[model samples]
Target: MRVVHRLFEMLIPRRPVSHQAKDRDNLQDWKNYVYGRARSAWARGLPLYGSSFRFTIVYLCGDSPADIDNIIKPIQDALVGVVFSDDSLVSDVDSHRRFISDGIDLTNLPALLIEGALSGEECVYVAVDSAGPLGSYL
Candidate 1:
């Protein structure tokens, strides 16, 4: 999931607000929406790199569908010969699914932990349900 994490870090520059913050509700909504898109992408065998892949661009504070589209415009412009779309926004599940189906590899995406502040404090962050690709990709 390094790729996903790295991409997320790159895309979102500011440190994320603590999960307890009131704004966190909005953040969580966006996070969940993005996670679903990633899950769908992983189900399909598509490479994350290159123009053919569609990326989910997130806007944190005042993020709207139109705002995200504007932010990712440059990324799309730079990478010519590839199809890119920013159809999903925070709290929008239908658009998220549509973007995921457009062909982005999300095999390395991180799973969301929705509990709360206590959940964030846990040392063992995440657990996988099945024996899946972990070290193979690296």
Candidate 2:
């Protein structure tokens, strides 16, 4: 013999001005707000995938407060996990050092010495090729 189960509904109170009513209203507003925020955020982020990649050298350029904040915000949001050099560790260099430093792991720091040496050599070669003063003679 086969048995069939019937669905039953319990009538819950839909009282307004009560805690449940307030919670329902708050939940609806929260859902709408979150949906809007997600839509806007995805629209803004979508273009990044199609954009050409530019390798930026973030050396000491004496950036403005807003510029620094703008650069840091994306890194923080993406959780890129940056490892700062010694110069970045000096006193009073960064105001939000405490917050920024917390996520970084020192063990994963890139080799500055090797990178600097290689970059300098590459720049010199590029400069020599561009400064072709004795072009016709060659």
Candidate 3:
């Protein structure tokens, strides 16, 4: 199986309100950034994966906490055409969020931590691949 990974080295924008007259600008901005990143990554010519794919996302954030569902929806939508041709092809999604220190620690861990005890700049890592019979579900 081949897994394609892309990291957007910044905090993912939250899904904006959907009232067309109210938050249109915010909604558009969020979509622009997310889609732009996915489009750029897609340009790398990764293989067009088959169905039964897995999607994994790791979000490293600072002190402020955000709703997991809100954070993941944009990413899932952004990757539709770029990663899997369509979202229906995805069969599994595993996602996580951590305040840097809550993740793997190394002797050099302190160097990566900041005043917030995590990198001030949030990071979103997305990995996708075509695979089957994964984990306990299989």
- Please tell me which predicted candidate would have the highest lDDT against the true structure: 3
**Candidate 3 or 1, higher lDDT:** 3
* Candidate 2 Cα errors over 4 Å, as ranges: 1-22, 44-138
TM-score per candidate, chains pooled: 0.23, 0.18, 0.64
For residues 1-138, write the lDDT of model 2, one tens digit per residue.
322121110111111121233466654553344334334333223222211121122222211222333333222222111111122221111212111212333343234322423332211000001111233225
RMSD of each: 15.4, 27.8, 6.0
Task: Enumerate residue pairs that collide in model 2.
Answer: none
What is the RMSD of candidate 1?
15.4
Better of 2 and 3 by TM-score: 3
Best by TM-score: 3
Superposed Cα deviation of residue 11, candidate 2 (Å): 38
**Candidate 1: worst 10 consecutive residues by lDDT?**
89-98
In candidate 1, stretches whose alpha carbon ends up further than 4 angstroms from where it belongs are 1-9, 14-51, 63-66, 78-138
Instruction: Give candidate 3's TM-score.
Output: 0.64
lDDT of 3 by residue, 9-47 (tens): 223333222223256677566667777777765654553
Candidate 1 lDDT, 1-138, residue by residue in tens: 223322221222222233344564755554554344444434324323322232343333222122333334333332222122222211111112112223334344344312211222211111112122435324
lDDT of 3 at 28: 60
